[model samples]
Target chain A: MLEYIVLGMVNYEDMTGYDIKKYIESGISVFYKASFGSLYPILKKLANKGLVAMYESNHGDRKKNYYHITDEGRKAFEIWLETPIMIDDGNGTQLVKIYFYDLLQEDKRRELLIRYRENNVTYLKGLYELEEQYVNTRNKDCYYYKLSVLYYGIRIIKETIKWCDDIIERKDLSEI
Target chain B: MLEYIVLGMVNYEDMTGYDIKKYIESGISVFYKASFGSLYPILKKLANKGLVAMYESNHGDRKKNYYHITDEGRKAFEIWLETPIMIDDGNGTQLVKIYFYDLLQEDKRRELLIRYRENNVTYLKGLYELEEQYVNTRNKDCYYYKLSVLYYGIRIIKETIKWCDDIIERKDLSEI
Candidate 1:
C-alpha cells in the first residue's frame, strides 16, 4: 500500500524521497504515516520494479535522488484507481484513493464513490444486525465496551457515506 | 499491538487460536484484523515471554491448544490500559483500547476518554487550519480530492470525539 502511495505521490510530480516524506506528513498524516526508514526502502523497491526511475540532482552541494513515475507506473496507478474498493479495506486505503481521484476520469470517480458508498450501506446493515444480536444476548462482561466499538464503526461508516454523497452531489469538483 | 490484543482476548477466557481469530472477526473486524499466519507466531511469543500459558485440551477427538492469560499478562494489559493513548495512533489502536476498557477502573476509564477526546479536539483544530490554508491557496490539480480526504479526517475525528462524549456521559456501562 505504501508502494502505491509513493507511486501516487510521484505521479503528481518528480520528488526527492525527502520531498515525498514531507508531502505525506503535510497531507495525510492524520490517517496515514510513513517513516524515513520505511519510505526509502519502498522508493528503492519501486525503482527496482521499474515503476519509478531515480536520478541524482544537486540540492546545494548535496546530491539527492529524485524519483519520477514511469509510463508503466502511471498505468499501474490507473489500474489501482479503477479497481473496486472493498468495504473492509479500512479508511486509509480509501483516503489514498480519493486523494488521487483527480487522476481518474470524472465518470470513474463518481462510479467508484458510488460503489464505495453502496458497499458501506450494505455493511451498515450487517452491523445493525450484529448490534441486535448483542443486545439480545447481553451476556458478556465486556458487552458495553464491545457495543461501544461497534457504535464507533457504525458512526464512521455512516459519515463516510455522507461524505461520498456530498462529493457526488457537488456540481463540479472545483466548486468547493 | 497484536500482542496486547491477543493478551486482552485471553484475559477474557482461555481459548484456542481459532477462537481468538473468530472473536476478533466478530468483535472488531471493522477496524482490525489478524490472519492466522501472523497470529500464531504472536501467540507463541507471548507464551515464551510467560505472558500467557498454553495448554492442550481435547475437544471431541481433536487436541486444541488453548491460551490463558498469566498474572504477568494481566499486569501488562493493565499497564497498557493505564497508558496515555497518543492522538496519531489511529482508530484501530484506540478502538482496541476501548474494547478492553471494562478491565480499567471507572476513574481510569473516564480519564482516558477525556484525554482521548481532548487530543482529538486539539488535532481537529489543526485540521481546520489546514483546510483554511488549502482553501486559500488551491494551487494543485488534485485540490478537490486532497480537500475531500482532509474533510474525511475531520469528520472521522469529530465522530470519535462525539463517541467519547457519549460513553463518558452514560450513567453506567450496563445501562445501555
Candidate 2:
C-alpha cells in the first residue's frame, strides 16, 4: 500500500522522501500516513522495480534526490486505481479496547468512554476545519475528490461521537 | 494486540489454539483477527512468559492443550484494558484510493463510488442483524459493551455509504 501511495503521489508531482512525508502529513494525514522508517525502503524498492525513477537536484550545498513516476509506474498506478478496495478487518484498536472494557468497573468504564469521546470530538473539529479549507479552495481539478475523502473521515468521526453519546446516555438512564 | 486479545479470550475460558482461532473468527473478526502463522508463535511466547498456563486434556485418542490465563495474565490484561487506544493513521485504503481517483474518467469514477456504496450497504445490513442478535441474547454480562463496538462499526459503514452517495449525486448534478 505504501508502495502504491508513493507511486500515486509522485504521479501528481515529483518528490523526495522528505517531501512525500510532508505532503502526506499535510493532506491525507487523516486517512493515509507513512513514517520515515518505512518510507525510504519502499522508495528504494519502487526504484528497483522500475516503477519510479530518481533524479538528484542540487539544493544549495546538499544534493537531494526526487522520485518521479515512470511510464511503468503510471501504468501500474492506473491498474491499482481500478482495483477494488480491500475490506479492513484488522487494526481497529479502539473497538478492540472497547470489546474488553468489561474488565473495568462501571465507574472506570464510564470515565474511559467519556475521555475517548472527548478526544474524538477534538479530532473531529480539526477535520471540519480542513473541510472548510478545501471547500474554499478553487480551480483544483482534484478538489472535490480530496473533499470526498475528507468527508469520509469527518462522517466516521461524527458517527463515533454519536455512538459515544448513546452509550453515555444509556448509562444515565440506568442511574436514574 | 493479538497477544492481549488471546489473553483476554483465554481469561474468559480455557481454549486451545484452535478454539481461540474459532472464537476470534466468529466474534471480533471485524476489528481483530490473526492467522495461525502469527497466532501460534504469540501463544508460545505468552506461555513462556507465564502469562498463560497450559493444561493437557484428552479429546478421544488425542491430547489437546488448553490455555488459561494466570493471575499475572489477568493483571496484564487489566493494564491493557486501561491503556489508551492507538490511533489508526494508516490502512484507510478506500479513502486513499478515492484521493487519487480524479485520474480516472468521470463515468468510471461514478461507477466505482456506486460499487463502493453498495458494498458498504451490504456490510452494514449484516452488522444490523448482529446488533439485533446481541439485543435478544440474555445473561451476557458484557452484552452492552460488545454492542457498543458493533454500533461503531455500523455507524462508520453508514457514513461511508452516505459519502459515496453524496459524491455520486454531485456527479449527476454536474452532468445535468
lDDT of 2: 0.67
What is the Cα-based lDDT of residue B91 in candidate 1? Answer: 44
What's the residue-level lDDT of B22 in candidate 2? Answer: 88
- Over B46-153, each residue of candidate 1 has an lDDT whose tens digit, in order, gives 999999999999989999999999999999988987887777764456567888787777888899889988998999999889877788887755577787788888
lDDT tens per residue, model 1, A40-114 = 999999999999999999989999899999999999988987887787764445567778787777898889889
Model 2 bad stretches (over 4 Å): A88-176, B88-176
Q: Number of clashing residue pairs in every model?
A: 0, 0
Specify the highest-DockQ model's number: 1
User: Candidate 1 docking: what grade?
Assistant: medium
Model 2 has fnat of 0.53
- Positional deviation of residue B159's Cα in model 1 after best superposition, in angstroms: 0.8
lDDT per residue for candidate 2 within A97-157, as digits (tens), equals 4543544567766777787788778766776776565557654455566456656666676
The TM-scores, chain A only, for the candidates as listed are 0.90, 0.51
TM-scores for all predictions: 0.92, 0.53
